[model samples]
Target: MSKTTRATQALQQAGVPFTVHAYAYDPNAERIGLQAAEAMGVDPGGVLKTLMVLVDGKPACVVLPSDREVNLKKLAAALGGKTAQMMKPADAERITGYHVGGISPFGQKKRVPTLVEQSAFAHEEVFMNGGQRGLQVKLRPADAVSALGAQVAELI
Candidate 1:
């Protein structure tokens, strides 16, 4: 796709090699993560979802596989924080500068600590939001880790 978004721009500027993937967005679909995986015909395990979580009231980004859930206790322990809670949709958007459904851990209005699930690196490449609904970016797991300053953790 020729369309550009903050996430794409960030990746480009950082010289991170990536491929863009786009699919029809279903506004009414209840499970967007599953829908995207189905639309792309890719393994759900290779699709990463960006989640904004608060670690002691400070926003942090957690990147994990679409097929898994973030273990709050594990995440908190990994971050060395006493508490962790998901950011409200509005708060996530406001903080990440992307809509809730399109948040990418790669680019944001501000930088926050990022933790990527350790298992995600098992995939050669992972697909994630491209800063907009219906758009996804495919990139090497290591490149994502390096470019985003993310630490691999047992978030799942």
Candidate 2:
């Protein structure tokens, strides 16, 4: 058996039910979320992407629908922070120990506060990156929050 990645290992430890989907790499793919949705045969709306943002000068994670972009003002309000800004890719990599396309809300190298868009709750399961490129995990939104100790909010 192959060694599980940090994301998978965390899910297993937390007893969060999930299914792994793997697909061939398309070098031409532009958006990570779209790639995952296409590869997993799921609706773009049902796929969520993890974004790193700095809220009030603190690193935070925002999980949003793949089809939409994060609204910084709404995110700031949801987080009760004065401001929210996108984190630099290098800073994100340093904080999560994963590249931009492979960043998972769970099992990050550092425990940063996280918020998931409330829309995600409507879906039975959401597809998100599995700590590696070309791999994604299908899991309940609630389970994801529990695993990551994240807060659910209207962050769209």
Q: Quick one: best lDDT, which candidate?
A: 1
Off by over 4 Å in 1: none
lDDT of 1 at 97: 86
Q: For candidate 2, write residues 1-156 as lDDT tens digits.
A: 122679999999999999988865465787778877887777999989889999999999999888889889999888888899999999999999987788988789999989999999889988877888777888999999899888888876
The lDDT, on a scale of 0 to 1, for candidate 2 is 0.87
Error of 1 at 93 (Å): 0.6
Clashing pairs counted in every model: 0, 0
TM-score for each predicted model, relative to the true structure: 0.96, 0.94
Q: Runs in model 2 with CA error above 4 Å?
A: 1-3
Residue-level lDDT for 136 in candidate 1: 96
Whole-model lDDT per candidate: 0.90, 0.87
Q: For residue 107, what is the lDDT in candidate 1?
A: 76
**Distance (Å) between predicted and true CA of 69, model 1?**
0.2
Residue 152 of candidate 1: its Cα lDDT? 94
